[model samples]
Target: MISLEHANRIVGATLEKGKALGLKPLTVAVLDAGGDLVAFARSDHSSAMRPQIAMGKAGGALALGVSSRTVGDMAADRPSFIASLGPISRHGVIPAAGGVLITDGNGTLLGAVGVTGDTSDNDESCALAGIESAGLKAKN
Candidate 1:
């Protein structure tokens, strides 16, 4: 099983990389297949809201079974469905930066990763690195 510690290790490693690269402090989250937080971390300087934002993004990815980037594109093309999802998600409706789908080697939905602090692109890259380092898959 991809335990919470495994996920946190990935998030921590990615954060270390981000710090080395001069990125801002961030909040990172990893969810289980049930869209529940299995791991979560916030940089020393990260804002209090960062964790919630990360969780929201991760939740969205898990619920849709797609990357948050795809969710953004879908929301752009289908506003109705996207809008409806806002209320439906309740806790998983971020549709923002730094969210990704996590999968097993066989492409099973394992969970998701979400990051916040830098630009969405940077967040995405960090999250991708974290997931990949954990021997999981993410839509790069």
Candidate 2:
């Protein structure tokens, strides 16, 4: 479980890392193991779709039990299969980076963090930084 405090910390740290890296304004969404939003934040000047994109990234990861980067790979390998999931999934599926599963030290699934508003690689970096700042482990 991701407490509200942890979720907030992750959001803050994610945005801070994005700023530090000179990336674009970022939107972050933290989701519990059940794929429910725990915390979310969108920086000023972020596009309107950022919230949905962030949620989709995290929700897609949770739904598949893998990082969104892996989801992207899967999408690349099986485009039709990945596209078929969009309509059936509650949060939709975003096959891109910046969505990472969170785990405890014992490797227990806790939650996930999703980030958007920059390049996929940069967003993923911010997500990892946020998870680490919260003293949480990122499921590889």
Candidate 3:
């Protein structure tokens, strides 16, 4: 489980990282292992769909047990399969690089963090930064 405190830290650090990199306005979502939203935030200028996109990224990672980057790769290799997941998944599966799974020191799954509103790589960097800032490990 991800405590609200850590979830908030992840959101803050993710946004801070985006700002530091001079990236576009970002939206972030943190989800627990069971794919439940723990915390979420969207920058003022973020697009309307950002909230759903962020949650999808995080939820997809949690559901698939892999980073969203890997999901993107899978989409490339198996488009139909990845696309099929969308209809069944509650948050939908977003095949992007912004979603990352979080773990503890001993490799216990904790939660996932997702970021958006910038390039996929940049979004992923922010997610990684946020996880690190919280002293958690990213299963990237």
Model 3 segments more than 4 A misplaced: none
- State the C-alpha lDDT per candidate: 0.80, 0.95, 0.93
Per-residue lDDT of candidate 2, residues 1-140 (tens digit) = 89999999999999999999999999999999998899999999998899999999999999999999999999999999999998999788899999999998999999999999999999999999999999999999
- Residues 16-134, candidate 3, lDDT per residue (tens digit)? 99999999999999999988888999999787999999989998998899999999999999999999999899899999999999998889999999899999999999999999999
- lDDT of predicted model 1: 0.80
How would the candidate models be sorted by TM-score, starting from the highest? Answer: 2, 3, 1
Best by lDDT: 2
CA shift at 32, candidate 3, in angstroms?
0.7
102: Cα error in model 2, Å? 0.4
Better of 1 and 3 by TM-score: 3
Model 1, runs deviating above 4 Å? none
Model 2 regions lying over 4 Å from their true place:
none
- The clash number for model 3 is 0
Q: Give the TM-score of candidate 3.
A: 0.98
Ranking by lDDT: 2, 3, 1
Candidate 1 backbone collisions, by pair:
none
Pairs with steric clashes in candidate 2: none
